[model samples]
Target: MPESATLPSATTKLEYLRKDLEDLRYYLDEFSAFLPLSVIIVNPQGFILDINQAFENLIGLEKAGVLGSTVAKLFCEQEQFAELEARVLKGEVIKGARATLLLRDRQISRSLYLSPRHDCEKNIIGYFLGIYDISENVKLTEGRNGTVCARTIELEEKSEDLLRSRAALMNILEDVAEEQKKVEQERDKTLAIIKNLADGILIFDPHNVLTLINPQAKEMMQLDESSVVGKMAAALTKVTNIMPLINFLGRNIKKVYRKQLELKSDKVLEISAFPFLTGRETLGKMVILHDITREKAIETMKTEFVSVAAHQLRTPLTTVKWSLHLLLHGNLGAITAEQRDLLMRTDEHNERLIGLVNYLLDVARIEQGRFVLRNKNVDFIKLAETVIAPFLEVSKNKQLNFKFIKPREKVLPVNVDEEKMVLVIENLVDNAVNYTPPHGNVTVSLSFDKAKSEVLFTVKDTGIGIPEDNKQRIFTKFYRAENAAMASTSGSGLGLFITKNIIEGHGGRIWFESIQSKGSTFSFTLPLK
Candidate 1:
């Protein structure tokens, strides 16, 4: 015979199983309702699938209300319920597991019996839960064992004990309920604050599943709460509006601070992420999106203003500088030593102004993405030497001990824009000399790291080092440390900012270490060609 003819198809078998299960449930329910013991049917997960009328009365809860709730919810001793379920699910039948059943307004002592239910294939599918009220049984047993007068006295004592126990249970339950209410209130307040926050907020659990997305976040991401919550981070990439943010964060939602993400041409957000930690455990991560459109607009406006103002002032400053140069050189007319001195000072001041204007123009170009690099292979040691040569006289005049330490071996050339590289080296050497006190030491060193294929340049100064609190903003544009400002009042504060951009543009890194009142070491590295 063919297999199809010999046995029922899978669909037919499924139909037969369903019919058998329905019939079994019907008979069990009818039989259990008539029995004196309370009975309930629970799935393998311990959720109530069916409850008999007797079980409903025993717990003082309606069958409609009790169905779909966990069996443990009806019991005051949840640990005992858990133990009973564990034993029964392991194919061990439980009999008379003592427990307390929580009623509508009181508690009752009960004994529970649980046995696993199996299908035709002997696979455990559910459990049969039976409860017996043991209070009446205890009373009956006490009455059977003693004389009437002695029993009467014992019964009175037992009654007093039962009343005290019930009173204590009621007090404990009331306290728990009051505490729960307080917790609920606090949770509501926290949710209210998060919901009303101007900044968007997204909270993901340790599994990277979206646990909470506040209203602002939903609106900003243009997502529906019903569709987005409970989704994993990877799944969010499918969403058009939020895809850029997800891509920027990548697969790992690490701790990032104040990084700019342009969601659209008109909308810019400063995104930050941090782990939500409790003690030593990381519970989840929270991503905050703060709108920065207005700040970016204002910054653009300031950069444009600086660029225009610098361009307009440069021509006049150059004219004055050339006129003073001619007069000081006697190209225009013969002048006395005193006139020459005044003209030279005027030329010096004019040059300083021109340098400031140039710095402003460079900053504007950097902001506008117009700063370009023209890279070529050149000896880095020679470049460093050329930049440091001009600072030697300045340091000598201040009586500062200056030194340039180069590597003993010939180093490979680095690919960089020579002009900008000169600026980088000049800025570091100048800061070291200008900040050092008279008789203080300033050292500029160069070394090659073959293992990393890079050259390290360091400038160390035994001078008034940067303050600890101000170290974080050392390379910030136009930011001068209080100590540096006190030491020299003549600086544009744009040198380091421009220097950092140049180094980073060459695919290099720059950093510094300093201790207040001790010394400072500024270092940078460039990859060798």
Candidate 2:
């Protein structure tokens, strides 16, 4: 009914394909019937399908009469046909084998080639045989007692051609040998890496069939070498802590997933997996299993000590902050201007120290899995407005124009920890405002991405953007970009790190785009319910 629907469909394509196939078969039959050298086509079951005119001439038979006959039953030696069948059907190409064909009244010696034809699935469907007349060259004999005459120049030319061929073949063989040596060396290096590795090695083929298990993996699993290969990797679930094989295969995780797994009683393995990719294919995963019980114990001890120390220092720090605030605000008594300025500076420095301590405590809580979220369904734009207000006043003092683009759909709700979400937005806007120069602008926006089913938050700043070297480590704690360090000296560098943790805890994603000396934009997305 539509103009575009008038084009050819599946039936049209099928008819075109039939026509092409018919033309191809006709051309092939003509070429084979006229060719001088003998050629034979046969089915996998060894029955002859067709033959060339040369083959029919040699055999003194009409091919149309013996189309379904077996080549081994006539026209060739029985022993050789059986040997050829065994070799060719197994996918080996046998070339230049000396075979004698039984002609009408005599035997003809020729060089034979037998090769199997396969379908896309690599199953043998038929065989192709080519016979070359090599009896003239093989029957030639050298002159008796090395004598030569002027009439022997053709034979001398043939000898020289043979010598050149021999030299060329030797060069090819040497090249092949060198290539083989390099391959062998590389193979040995890979095997050494696998066998001597502290972790296990499991290699699966493109078809998801396990093909290799090294000595280290065998030892770790206490498995017999013979039973592992040629099977699926699903067996790992029985003796190791890997997920069920279904989740493990074809998952291009793009990052290393580390897990502390108990393979058996008293056995602890730290497993890390990355989707093993080469060229363009995801192929499979490479998993490393390490014994990290001792490392875990050391980390646990370190975390406990820091937690205890932070709790002890919190009381004194709170007292200092409160005392400084009272003195600066004249709550205790009237103070001289200079004394107030001194107290104000002290209060600012004290706040910086307090922020650092809080960041450290938060990091510890995250590491210990003690950072808990109280999720509530809250209006998303209202949350953004509340956080954006403080940054507006802060930026105005520095002459940076602050902007907040409210979402068109202003009533979207998201389930999140309200306090933690505020921390994320505050850190982003604070960083943007702090980094931008006077008269520069900072913008924050909220929007719903219907395709991803997520609410997007973006912070754009006309600031001295992150340098190339520091961009990779921007989210790492205590890592400040060179430009950022040059522009300001007061930041703790823990904001983005904390922001990343909070966002991921909310099942969100965060990333940024920046160019040095130009500007930067940080974007994050949270799910909208």
Best by TM-score: 1
**Model 2, global lDDT:** 0.75
lDDT by residue (tens digit), candidate 2, 411-441: 5579999999998998998889888899998
Q: For residues 268-366, what per-residue lDDT tens digits would candidate 1 score against the true structure?
A: 899999998866778899999998889999999999999999999999999998898889777988999989888888888999899899999999999
lDDT of each: 0.83, 0.75
Task: Record all residue pairs in model 2 with backbone atoms less than 3 Å apart, i.e. clashing.
Answer: none
Q: Which pairs clash in model 1?
A: none
C-alpha RMSD between model 2 and the true structure: 20.6
Once model 2 is optimally superposed onto the true structure by TM-score, how far is the C-alpha of residue 227 displaced, in angstroms?
A: 4.4
Q: After superposition, how far is residue 428 of candidate 2 from its true place, in Å?
A: 0.4
In model 1, which runs have C-alpha deviations exceeding 4 angstroms?
1-171
